[model samples]
Target: MARIGVIGTGYVGLVTAVGMATLGHEVVGMDKDEGKIRKLKGGEPPFYEEGLEDYLKRAMEEGRLRFTLSTEEAVKGARYVFIAVNTPMDDDGSADLSQLLSASRSIARALDGFSILIVRSTAPVGSLDAMVEVMREEGKERGRDYELAYNPEFLREGTGIYDFLNPSRIVVGADTPEVAEEVMSLYEGINSPKLTTSIKNAQIIKYASNAFLAARVSFINEIAAVCEALGGDVWDVAEGIGLDPRIGRHYLRPGPGYSGPCLPKDLMALIRMSEEYGHFPHFLEAIHLRNEAQKRRVVWKVKEALGGVFTGKTVGVLGLTFKPNTDDVRNSISIPILRRMSKQGARVKAYDPMGGENAKAIFGDAVEVYNDPYEALDGVDAVLILTAWEEFAKLDWDRIRERVRRPYIVDSVGIFRRGAPEGWRAWTVGKGDLPSPEVSPESDV
Candidate 1:
């Protein structure tokens, strides 16, 4: 087993450390955040990721994994140093590499012997070269003192641990074939095909993959809107189109928009990166613009369901996260929708299985976060299902009907596939089966 040092204890860094340790490697995870290091060392995950604590605890007990705040302690005597630091998006959608560059400089100073530095951060092309430059400026020649490699991560937040152990593919782009081989050996435990490429290709691979997925999502969302207008069903249309192996059935689900730690920012960053390289990515720009438009469309849907007014109205939201089983709410559609409603004098209440804390942090007093789904719906004028959580799907419709102040329901996630109750008004994405408003047909106004 090789000795591994991972810098950064975020979702990517911490998960990679625990996973590598579980594979029988001695791992030390480092983070500048003292409190985050303390929490991980105490067997607590700083964020809400499933299966993280158990893996961390098990690896800790096995003496294979440890957490630290000192980069020196982590890098000393390590064969592989994985740079998993955050590359946040700047105002112009360029990746802010301040943290990554700082980590690289710190790691450069601590390099004792020949150790492979793997950049697992989602950065622009040539970032690996930039790190190599940093190492050279720190008095370490690439071939003599150290080496740099780009190995981007594809781990999703909720199912990250599993994805790490069972990745679809592993890619590492190094300066030399020898370094690529060494990087491959580190992932020998994972039964995934390894692809070796140039460092620039690997960096672009991550960005390109994310941008393509975001494009598919936006494309389907546009079709979903058309379906809603023309009495067509998007789910069935997607099903038929997905049967073709070339057009696989992934990221095709219609929703308000694609959000999370990756999709939105990655698309924007890719666009910016392309511009920097003197390329005008018109198609990618369309995808980006369509995503923003989708969120606004959702807000319009909510207002339309409320009889074209939000003044003095109340809305209940069933989910706050971008998706189910994750606490990440970065760029989530629910945020804009809920905030827009609140600004229009419509009180907003929301419940999520895992994202409530993050929702509270983001929305503050503007939106109400609730523990129980029924409680979130209590006396609201309309209910919107933004995320596809099983708990939200299995809600007692009978009880919800009694608790909700109005019968107006909009399911953007296809929760009510069997259709809503007879006497209620309902709408959904792409289904196009909107029942008439809940006015008694026998009454002649």
Candidate 2:
């Protein structure tokens, strides 16, 4: 088994570290944050991902996985050094690779022997060229002293571990065929279709993949609007198109737009790159704008459901994280929707299974975060279901109706039925028609 060293301890890095160890490789992961390192060393991960804790604990127990705060310790005597750090987007929509450059320079200085530095971060199209230049400036001779390769990670937030081990495809971009084959050997344990290409193609593939997924979401949202306009259903439309082999049934389900660490940032970065190349991508730009508009669309649905008066209205928000099974709230739609509602003189109460603390930190007094989902609904006029979490799916509709002031629900996710509680009124996305049942004396909601 080859020794592996991974930098950064975020979702991708931490997963890579523990995952590689589970594949029988001795792996060392490094992070600058001492607190994170301590937590990782104590068999605890800073964030939540499904099955990561168990996988981490097992790797630690097996003596295959370890974390370090020192870069020197991580890179020394390692055959493969993977850079899985963040390349956060700047204010002007460009990617700030300061952290990536810093990590590369650290790796260069700490390189004790011939090792392959595989970049697994989601960077710009030509970022590998810049990283190579940066490493060369650090007095490291490329292809002789060390080798560079680009192997961008394509793991989802919730099911990242599964995606990693059972990837649909594995991409390896390198300066030479020999280096690419060596990188591919590292993933010999993983049984996925592999592809070797240029560094630039590998880099662009990540961005293009996310951009297309985000566009699918935005297109469906726009189609959802039209479905409502023409008195049709988006679910039916999605199913009809999804049945075709060419257009698979994924990313067609619509909600409050796409928002996470990857989609929005990658979409913007690709747009910026296209602009730099003198080709203004109107389609990508529109996809981005439509995503933000989807958030506002949720607010509008809430306001309209509450009879157009935001003042003195207390709305309960369900699920603050962008998606389920993760506590990451980097670009969650619930935050902005809650802030906009509060600005319009409405009170907000939110509850997320894992994102409660993150919501409390971000919203402060603007939104009151609740640990229990029912507590958030206590005495609220309306409840807006943002994320399609499993708990939200299995909620007691009978008990929920008793807690809320009104049985009115704006289900952004199509979890609620049309007439489940007899009198509860729910507005679900892509529902073909709204039902008007006969209200009894006990059913006047």
Candidate 3:
């Protein structure tokens, strides 16, 4: 079994550490956050991911995984060191590589033997070259001391563990075939397609993948708008278009646009990188602008449902995270939507099955976060569904109908496209009219 070191211990790094350990490798995860390290040492995951705690505890019990704050301890005697640090977007839309570069420098300083430093962080195309330069500044020779490779992660937040173990494809980018093969060996137990190429291509692969997915989301959302205008259903439209073999049925669901950490950040970073390379990415820029407009459209829907004004209205939000099954609120479309509603004199009551605390911290006094979904809906003018949590679909809508001032729903995520509770007036994306007056007690479409 190969000895592996994972730096950063954030979403990406922690998953990699545990995944590799589960594959029978001795792994160490390093992070500067004392509280996070302490939690991991006690079999606690700092964030929510399905099956992460079970796997973490199992790996620790098997003596294959451990956590530490010392970079030296993480990389010492390790043959493969994965750099999975955060590359947050800057105010100018470029990826701030401060944390990534710092991790590289630390690895360079702590190198005890020849190790392959595989970058799993989402970065711009020439980031590996910058890492080489950083290590060179630390008096480390590239060939003799270490090698660099790019192995970008494509794990989603909620299903990171499952995605890691059952990846569709694995791409390793290195200077030589031997280096690529060495890195690919780490995942030999997993049966999947593996590709090896230049580091630049691997980096572009990651950014391009995210940008394309975001484009698909924005594309469908725009189509949803068009469908609404033409009195057509986006669900049928997306299905008809997605049936084409070239366009598989994925990422076509329309909502408040794509808002997770990776899609928005990577799309912006790719746009910045393209501009730096003397290319204007018009399509990419439009996709981003469209996503922003989609969020505003959701708020506008809420206002329209409440008689064109947010003043003296209560909006009970169903979900806050970007998506379901994760407790992450960073870059969630709900944040901007909630902030806009609260700013416009609307009382916002929000709840999430998992993201409540994180969303509460972010919204503060602006939003009244509730633990109970039914309580949040009490005396509300309209219910806004942002994240598509399954529980929201299974909510006791009959109970909700009796509590709310008005049984109005702005279903941004289309959770009620199939049908909402009887006697409820709802505005669903892509669907022109829903819950007809004949089927409901009140008639407001």
Sorting all predicted structures by TM-score, with the top scorer first, yields: 3, 1, 2
lDDT of 2 by residue, 1-445 (tens): 9899999989999988987888889999999999899999999999988888899999999999999999999999999999999998889897889999999889989998999888999888767777778889998888777888899898988777888889999999986888899889888878889999888888888889999999999999888877876778888898898899899999999788888788988999999988987999998999999888888888988887777777888999999999988999887888788899999999898899999998788888999999998888998888899998978867887888887777888888777633444557877776657752223312445
* C-alpha lDDT of all candidate models, in order: 0.86, 0.86, 0.91
Candidate 3 per-residue C-alpha lDDT over 259-300 given as tens digits, one digit per residue, 9 for 90 to 100: 978899999999999999999999999999999999999998
Question: Each model's number of backbone clashes?
Answer: 0, 0, 0
Find the number of clashing residue pairs for candidate 3. Answer: 0
Q: Specify the highest-TM-score model's number.
A: 3
TM-score of 3: 0.96
Worst 10 residues of 3 by lDDT: 435-444
